[model samples]
Target: MDAVAARSGVHRTTVYRRWGDVGGLLADVLDAASDDDWQPPDTGSLEGDLAALNQEIQTAMAAQPPIMAALIAASFRSEKAADAQQRLWEDRYARCEIVVSRAVRRGDIPPRTDARRLLIAATAPLYHQLVLLRTPHDPQLPGHAARTAVLAAAAGAFAEPEPPSADDT
Candidate 1:
């Protein structure tokens, strides 16, 4: 709090009164981020769109000072921050669902494809390498992961399971 106030040129008491604590501050920060109008890229093809999105994720995750990583770590320690982060993720996922919808419309993937699963698969490699294992950035990672996920998704890997038929019962 003190550091934030000092950095922002606000008084410590004012900052404390406004945000209450670190958790509240982090929550507000996350909430503010969620309020942005961020949309996934539409490159006319599923592979191109997924690759573009993965590239964006890689760039953000690889940024110096690693703000996204710090926010994710802090969310684990703060309920408010965790909730806010969840909301942020939900918002982002909802926005990105349009990508999957477009793919289905274009006959690139199955109709019942699970957008969230497909997106996670496409982007998880970047998070695993940069955030979890802390591996050095690989320039080819984004496109490779995106291509792999596109293949899997097109093969029905992320398709929703069909309801059991009455005859099965």
Candidate 2:
């Protein structure tokens, strides 16, 4: 209560009066802490596609583990953190859904493509190294490894089918 009031330059009584208690203030802040960067590359080539998307995902998470970690720790004590985290994760994956759907419509990706898995596959090796395996999230290593794994998985996986000309099927 005191900490929240101090941070916000408000009286503790004011915060308590508005939110009801210290837990309420914590819950609101946790709900509001978001680390989202919603932009995907539209490079003409799939290789560019893999690189751009993974970079956004991998770098953003690595750069802000503290907020995520803090929220997770607080979630053990507050439902607000859990609800907010779930919502944020869904929104992040929704961006992947858009990428996959657009690629399928344009014949740039296979009809049976799994955008969610594809996004994860691109990131797995990097995370295995930097997180699971406890190696540093070496900017160079993750960037290179992510691009390579995704492109390798995608090679011949989704070649564009021959399109008919205006005159022919």
Tell me each candidate's TM-score: 0.86, 0.57
**Of the candidates shown, which would achieve the greatest lDDT relative to the real structure?**
1
Which pairs of residues clash in candidate 2, taking residues 3 or more apart in a chain or in different chains?
Answer: none
Residue lDDT tens for model 2, 80-133: 656765666555666665666676677765665666676666666764665457
All-Cα superposition RMSD per candidate: 4.0, 6.8
Alpha carbon deviation, residue 55, candidate 2 (Å): 2.7
The lDDT for every candidate, in the order shown, is 0.86, 0.60
Each model's backbone clash number:
0, 0
Residues 54-98, candidate 1: write the lDDT tens digits: 889888877766667777887888898888888988888789999
Candidate 2: regions farther than 4 A off: 1-7, 10-37, 62-65, 75-79, 105-108, 124-134, 152-169
In candidate 1, which residue pairs clash? none
Q: Candidate 2: what lDDT?
A: 0.60
User: Largest TM-score belongs to which candidate?
Assistant: 1
Instruction: Pick out the ten consecutive residues of candidate 1 with the lowest summed lDDT.
Output: 160-169
